[model samples]
Target chain A: MARRKGVESSIALADAVAMCKVDAISAYPITPQTHIVEHLSEWVNDGELDAEFIPVESEHSAMSAALGTSAVGARTFTATSSQGLALMHEILFIAPAMRLPVVMAVANRSLSGPISIWNDHSDIMAERDIGWIQIFAENGQECFDLTPACFKIAEDKRVILPTILNFDGFIVSHMIEPIEYWEQETFDKFLPEFEPQIRLDVKNPSTMGAVGVPEIYYEARMAQHMALVNSKPVIKEVFAEVSQITGREYKVVESYNMEKAEVALVMMGSLTETAMTAVNNLKAKGIEVGIVRPRLWRPFPTEEFLEVLGDISVIGCVDRAYTFGAASHPVASEVKSVLYTSDKRPQVREYVMGIGGRDVRIEEIEDMFMQLIEVKNTGKDFPIQYIGVRE
Target chain B: MEHLNVFASKLVPGRELFSPGHKACQGCAPALALRYLLKAAGPNTVVANATGCMEIISSAYPDIAWGVPWIHVAFENAAAVASGVESGIKVLQRKGKLAPGKVNVVAIGGDGGTFDIGLQALSGMLERGHDVLYLCYDNEAYMNTGIQRSSGTPMFASTTTSPAGEKVPGQSTGKKDLAAIAAAHNVSYVATANTSYPFDFMAKVDKAFSTSGSKLIHIFAPCPTGWRCQPSDIIKLGRLASQTGLFPLYEYQDGKYTMSEDLPFLKPIEKYLKLQGRYRHLSKEQIEIIQENINQRYEWLQKLSRVSQED
Candidate 1:
C-alpha cells in the first residue's frame, strides 16, 4: 500500500512519474504546466529519478524530441498547456500515427487572442482530433493517479498509442489535496518494465514514420483509428487492474446520484467535482438532480453516456470550451450529436460556464439544475446559456 | 593517417545504406551527397530525416530507400529528433538493453529545413551536445515545394519566391553563413563539404563520427531542376562552386579552422554563376557585386584559418 499525504497535484504528478521510472522527458516551460516539469527536473537533477530531461526550446521541438526518444524504445514524457500545446499541434498527430506510446500531461488552459492565462477546456478541445487516448481528471487524487495510469494505458501492447491526461490548469494542477504517493515497489505491480515491440534498433533495421502514399494512406489512417477505438477495452482493463491495486475504483464515465433522477448536469474536468456538491444541495431540497462526468474524453464512452441518460428527461451540459460558430459548445455539442441518433434521447440544454478560470459556484450549478428541471417540466429546451456572462 | 586526396581510390565499401531505384532527379547532388555520407557512416547508423526532397524521394510508404533504421518525422525537427534518438540510446545502453558504441545517430535536412524552420531545433541539439551528426544538404532553396527561396539561397540567385525582375533582383541577401553559425556553438566538429568533392566530404564524415559529441556537416548540393541548369551540368556546377571561391571546402574543429581543399587561385565567380540559368540574367554590375562578395568572404575565411594556425 502507498502512503497517503497531502500535496499539490503537480508535485503528486511528478512523484507518480518518478515512481513510474520513465526513460526520458523533453519539455518546454508553459504556464500552469511549468510546475509539473519543474518538479520533475529537480528530481532528475537530484538523482531521485534516473532520467534525461531535455530542456527543449519550444513545444514544437519538445514533442519532436519526445517522438525521437519514444521511437528508440524509451518510455518518454512531456507536459504543456495552451499555446504550448497548440504549438505542438503538428507533431501531436505524428505521435499516434507512428504508434509511439508517449505519455503527456496537458494542464487545460484557454487558447489566446485575448491572451488569458487561466484555466479552460479550449486547449485540449482544440486538439481533440489528434488521435491520442485523452482523459480528464476532476481532482488532485485523479490527477495524481491518472499520471501513472496514462503510461500504463499508453504502453500496453494492445494500445501502443500515445495518451494525454488533461487536468484543469489551476483547479486540479495547482490545488493541494490528499493524494496517495506510490512507492516504486507498488508501481512495479501496476506497470512492469517497458519492453518496446518496435523501435529503432541497429541490429534489426526498420523504417518508421515513412510517408503514406495516396494508395495506402486511407488504410493507414483507418488502422490508426481502429487502434484508438480498440484501446477502449485496454483502458478499462488497466483502470480495473489499477483499482484492484489501489482500492479506488475508476471508470470511463462516472455517475453521481443518477439513480431515479429526472434531471441532471453533464460535465467533465474539475467542474464535475463542484457539480457533485450542487447535486447534494439540490437533493436536500427534493430536486433529485445528478451529475454525469465523462472521465474518458477521446474514445468517448458514447454507449455509457447514452446508458446514463436513460430514463432521464433533461440534461444540462456544462462546457468550458466554446465551439466558436457552432450551434453549441464542445461537450454539449458532442452530447447532443451522440443523442441525435439515439433512441432514448434526453432534452439536453447547453450551459457554457466557468470559462477562463471563472469559479463554478455551487449556487450556479444549482441554478443550472433548476434550469434543467424547468426545461423538463415545460418540455422546451432553453437556448445555450453563457453562465456568469455579463449581459 | 592517409591523406584525404587519396580517399577516392581508397575503395568505398560495396554495402549501400541508401538503396538504388529511388526517386531523385537526374544528377541530383543531394542524392549523391547522401550516398557518400552513408558510405562513411556505414550501416550501424540510424538516421532522422526531415521532410524534404530526400525524405519524399526515399520514403514513399511501400518503397523505402533506407537500408539502415531511419525515421522521417516532419520538416523542421530532424535535429531535435536526432537528439532524442541519441539520448534514448544512451539510457538504453546504460541499462544494458543496448550495446554501446555500435550505432551513431544522424539527422539530415534540406536548406529550408536547416537554415530556416529547423534552425532552432538544430541550435538546441548542438548546444545540448548530443552525439549526433546533423547533415544539411544545402540545395540553396526549397526544391521539393517548387523551388522557393530559402535563407540559404545566395544573393542574385533566382528562385520562385525571389525572382529577378525590372524592379527586384533575385535574392537581395547573401547566403546565411550556417557553417560559422554552427561553429559559434563550439561543437566538437563542424564542416562545409560539397558533392563535387565526394572524397573530401566522406573524409570529414569519418572524422566527425570518430568523436562522441555534436557535429554538423553542411554539404553544397546543387539542384539542376530548381537552378534551371542542365542535368549534365549538376556535378560540374558543384565543382565550379568550390573552385570559384563561391563555396569553400573547410572545417572547424576545436576552435581551429582548416581548409581541406584551398585553391592556389580562385577562378572568376562568373565561371560558377554562368552555368546555371538561375544567375543567367545577372548584369555586369550585379556579377561584380557577387564576385566582390565572394572575394570578401574568402578573405575573411583565410584570416580565420591563419589566426587559428597562429594560436
Candidate 2:
C-alpha cells in the first residue's frame, strides 16, 4: 500500500491544487480531463485558489487565450485530453517556439474519429517531437509530485519551453489515491513567480511576432534548437533541487531492481505500476528481472538509460500506443536508435500494451517474462504481442 | 482659399517620417497621405506598418525609409501586434520608464490587408481601447499582388479575377463598410477621406490625434495601374470619386455625425467610372444603379447627421 487516506489509490487533484495554490488557470471542457478542471473552476469561483480563470470556448481558443495571457507575463496552466489536444496541436508547436513556460495537465486518452474514450498513448504519441518537455506519471502521487517540478524545469531560463504532465485516462486521472500534499508556502520557495524578459508594455512600444526574411530566419530557428539541447542539463539540476526540498529522489529514467537482471522490462506512464508488480512477482521465483520507466520523453534520456541498463541481455519494450503497421510503437523505434551506439546492445523486443483503456493484467506481464525466458533459452527473438486485446 | 492653404501646408511640411526613394508607384496616394499625415501628427510617433506595398517598399533589405522607430509585423495580425506595442507603452508610461509626451501609435495597412485579412485582429485591438490611430489607405484591390480584386473594390470595378466577362460584369458587391465596423467597435473617431481632398483629410488626422481611445481614418487612395488609367490621372480619378459622391468624406464621434466636406451637389458618376478601365464595360443602367446606391448611402448619412444635431 502507498500509505492510507480513503482507498489509498483515490485522492482529488482539486484537493491537492487547493493546497498547492495556482496563480492562473485556462480551461475548456474535454472528456477524461473535465473532472480535473471542474474542481479547479469551483475553487476559482468560490474565492479559494485566488487565480485568474479564463473560461474559453474551444480547445484551440483556450490554448490561444492561455498563450495570450502567458505572453503578458503570468504563471499559467490548463488541462485537456485526446481531441482537445489535437485541436491545440498548432499552438502546441507555437507555445514552445515562443519559449513561454506554461504548465499543462494531460489526462492521456485515445484520439478518435471512430470515437473511443479510453486510456492510451495515441494522443501524446502524435506530439512526441513538438519540442515540448513531456513527463508521464504512474499514479496520482507522481502526478502531484511532477507538477511542482514541472514549473522548475520549464522556467529555468535555459528551458523556457512549455511542459506537459501526463497521467493515464481512467487509470490515473479518474482513480483516487492518497497523495502527500505540499503547502502554498512550500511551493512559493520551490516554484517562484514567473517574470518574462519581453512582455507587452504599453509605455515603451516594442514589436513582437514579426515575420523574418531569410536573413534572420535561420538564426531564430538555431536559437530555439540550442535552447532545447541546453535544457537537458538544467532539467537534471532542477530534479536534484526538488529532491533536496521534498526528500523524494527522481531522475529522467527511474530504475527498479535493474542490477543483476538478465531480462529488463521498459515502459512508461501508469502501466509501469502494474509492470513493477509483475517484476517483483517474477523476482521472487528466481527469475532475474528489472523495470525502467521513462518519465521525460521529449529530451529522450539516451545516455542515462544506457548507463543504468548496462550488462542487460534482453530489453522488452512496452508502449501504450499501437503504431498501426510498423516494427513496433513510437517508443520502441526510438529505443532502437538509443541502443545503436552502445557497445553491448541488448536484444530489443517490442510489445504493444494496454491500448484503448484495456486492463493490463498481472498474468499478461508474467506471461511476457516466460516468453522472453523461452526466447533466451532457445536463442530466438521474442514475438511481439499486444498485452490486452479482444482477439 | 483658407482651407486650401491649411491643406497645402500639411502637404509641404519640412519633415518626412516616411522617407522618399521607396518603391510606391509614381503618385501613389498612400505615399502622399503619409507625407501629409506625418506633418499633421508630427515626428515623435510610433508607426506599425502592415505587410503590404508600404512595408515592402519602406523596409526592403536593410534600408529603412521610416525615419522614426517603426515596426513591420505580419499581414493579418498587425493590429494585434500594434496592440501589444501600445499596451507595452501604456505599462511603461505607468512606471517612470518612459519619457512624458502624448505618444501616437499609427497602424497603417492597405485595402486588402485591412478590410479582408486583418479584420479580426483590428476588431480585437479596437475592443481593447488602445489610444491608437488606425489609417487604412484603401486602393480598392490587391494592387501589391498585381491588381487582384479585394473586399474594398467598388461595385462595377474590374480586376484580373473580377473582370467584366460573359457571365458577370465586374465586381457586383459594394465596398466593405469599414468605417461602420470601426464605429460599431464604438471608437472615439471614425472618418472616410481621399488624397484629392488633402485639407479635409489632414483636419480629421488632427482630430484623431487630439481624441483619445481608438480612431480610424480610411483614405480612398486611387491606384492608376491597377485601375488601368494614365499614371497622371491619379489625382483626377480621386477628385472625381469624391465629386461624384461615390466616395464621400465624413467623420463620426461617439454616434455624432459631421460631414467634413460639404458635397455641394453631386456631379455625373460617369466622369468617375469612365476614366478607369475597371468600370469601362459597365452599361448606362449599371452606372445609374451604382449612382443611385451612392445617393442612397449619402441620404442615410444626412439622416444620421439630423439625428445627431436634433437636440
Q: What does candidate 1's lDDT look like per residue over B201-246, in tens digits?
A: 9989999998879999999999999999888998899988999889
lDDT of 1 by residue, A1-391 (tens): 7789989999898888888999899989998999999999999999888788999988999999999999999999999999999999999999999999999999999999789889999999999999999999888888878878999999988989999999999888898998887777878877877788889998899999898999999999999999999999999888887778778889888899999687988899888878888888888888798888899998988888888767998888888998899988889888888888788777878888888988778898888888888888888755888999887
Report, for all candidates in order, the number of backbone clashes: 0, 18
lDDT by residue for model 2 over A122-174, one digit each (tens)? 99898887778888878887777677788778877768888888889888888
Q: Could you tell me how far off, in angstroms, the CA of residue A62 lies in candidate 1 after the best superposition?
A: 0.7
Interface RMSD of each: 0.7, 6.0
Model 2, residue A224: distance off in Å is: 1.6
Name the TM-score of chain A in model 2.
0.94
Give the number of the best model, judged by DockQ. 1
Extract clashing residue pairs from model 1.
none
CA shift of B89, model 2, Å: 8.5
Q: Whose TM-score is greatest here?
A: 1
DockQ of each: 0.84, 0.14
| Fraction of true interface contacts that also occur in model 2 | 0.03
> What fraction of the correct interface contacts does each predicted structure contain?
0.81, 0.03
Candidate 2 overall Cα lDDT vs. reference?
Answer: 0.77
